[model samples]
Target: MAEPFWLVRPRHDGGSDYVRFLPSQEAVEVREGSHLPPQMPLLKRRQWLPLKEAEDCRRHLQQEGGFRSSEPLF
Candidate 1:
């Protein structure tokens, strides 16, 4: 098992939609549905959260928001 982490997906309109809990940092990425344009460069924005805060968010999203971590295709 991997440590829990929150995955944030920004909406195309504005703000963000809290995605799900992820297993690792390597799994984080801005995909097609994210706020960024398809041709936009990646990692233009980054937010670092403390371990405790991240875990808390992960649990909240799971219990309250009914979000689940998405498995990478590769």
Candidate 2:
């Protein structure tokens, strides 16, 4: 399987939004809920986006400091 792009952010309801790309489906998937403890993976709410829109969303989130790079700062 191809690698997927992933992102995550917190919600005002003390939950989280987990975003990932589904390469096979060629779309971005968003999962919203409390990520830990009480999360129901099978029942979590979801949204979908096109690749271009998803990339744009990621860029916007990064600008807001909601996403961080894995690379270490030298």
Candidate 3:
């Protein structure tokens, strides 16, 4: 089996910055804050790839590119 690729989006919830990762480019509801499961592996800022690179990964994985919000939702 292959390791899953995730599209990470940076978000802020009134106080701190948190990231939401959409696994395999799926359009799922993102959970807010720093309450992610401890079992989930996290990538350091230096280990994170660029958006274009992520897009390429999505193509290689044959996953759909989900919608991207340009403007702030707040």
Q: Which 10 residues in a row give candidate 2 its minimum summed lDDT?
A: 65-74
| Model 3 ranges with Cα > 4 A deviation | 1-47, 63-74
Candidate 3 structure quality by residue, lDDT tens digits, 1-74: 12333333333532222333343333322322322343343334333345556445445434443323223222
Provide the TM-score for each candidate, comma-separated: 0.40, 0.49, 0.24
- Which prediction has the highest TM-score against the true structure? 2
Q: How do all the candidates rank in terms of lDDT, highest first?
A: 2, 1, 3
Which digits, one per residue and each the tens of the lDDT, describe model 2 over residues 1-74?
24555566656766555555444467777543335437553335667877777677768766884754322111
Native-structure RMSD, model 2? 6.4
Per-residue lDDT of candidate 1, residues 2-33 (tens digit): 54334454455653444433345544322222
- Scanning candidate 1 in windows of ten residues, the lowest lDDT window is 28-37
Error of 3 at 6 (Å): 6.4
Residue-level lDDT for 11 in candidate 3: 31
The model with the greater TM-score, 1 or 3, is: 1
State which candidate has the highest lDDT: 2
